[model samples]
Target: MRGNLATSLRRRRRRCPIAQYDRLPPELRRWLAQAALPWSPVSALRLWHKLLDETAGNIEAARQRLDLIEARMLMRDAPRIWGVPPTVPPRQPSPAG
Candidate 1:
């Protein structure tokens, strides 16, 4: 299954029910719809809550943050999976305000 596909993130052998998916925030559901990786509800919701707080409830910002994280993971795994060097530099954290 796609959920069992190899990724930079560790794989978990568990079942995710539709009820779990239905309980996700609408914004997160939309984000997951287009996500390149199949994210489990538990992990996705964990990151969603973290990013929501970090972005001060700005949904779009959280979405972009997810994109950046996925991009970094793909880049990190490229050499191992695809045998190609990463094309982009790792994102640097912004200075604290």
Candidate 2:
């Protein structure tokens, strides 16, 4: 059935390591390094998610202030992949919608 197929697909996708830092700006990387330290497997992952959400919010706010249409455009066009959702709600609906 369709449900079974969807479940199987989800399982396959879950095996892939989602890319959380691939497109991070250098400044954001510096922020993350500072925020996420004394790394243990569990704590490191929690820190990474927290940093990613904070970084995304800051970037979106900057784009709003500067009225940089292209910044919004680039963010809009970026690919959606498996990762933690931002702490802030996304400006647009998710692709899964």
Candidate 3:
């Protein structure tokens, strides 16, 4: 079964020579990110396979785009906590002996 799946994937690659996610256009990558939502193990695997098949030819470019998208997403989603100074109690003087 695994062999059959592999063969099927190979056939698909031959039919569509486009590179993997690493080679995809920024627009396409963004589309993929949207498609990949509702994160679950199964969804992740499907997304991974899609990316792998799509990026097989243009791995480097796809990877670069993916990285850029990830960085942007991280920056957008970063926490926005306000700055606050810590308050420490004053040290008590030692009692005379």
Number of the predicted model whose lDDT against the real structure is largest: 1
Identify the runs in model 3 with alpha carbons over 4 angstroms from their true place: 1-56, 80-97
TM-score order of candidates, best first?
Answer: 1, 3, 2
lDDT of each structure? 0.89, 0.45, 0.52
lDDT of 1 by residue, 27-77 (tens): 899989999888889899999999999999999999999999999988888
TM-score of each: 0.68, 0.24, 0.29
Q: For residues 25-94, what per-residue lDDT tens digits would candidate 2 score against the true structure?
A: 5544444455423323343445445644755757545323323433454456544533544577558866
The TM-score of candidate 3 is 0.29
What overall lDDT, based on C-alpha atoms, would model 3 receive against the true structure?
Answer: 0.52
Cα deviation at 64, candidate 3, in Å, is 0.4
Cα lDDT tens digits, model 3, 1-97, are 5666655344532322234444555655555566423333333435445665777846566556555655665555554433443568899999999
Q: RMSD of each candidate? A: 12.9, 17.8, 14.9
Cα misplacement distance, residue 73 of candidate 1 (Å): 0.7
Per-residue error (Å), model 3, residue 75? 0.6
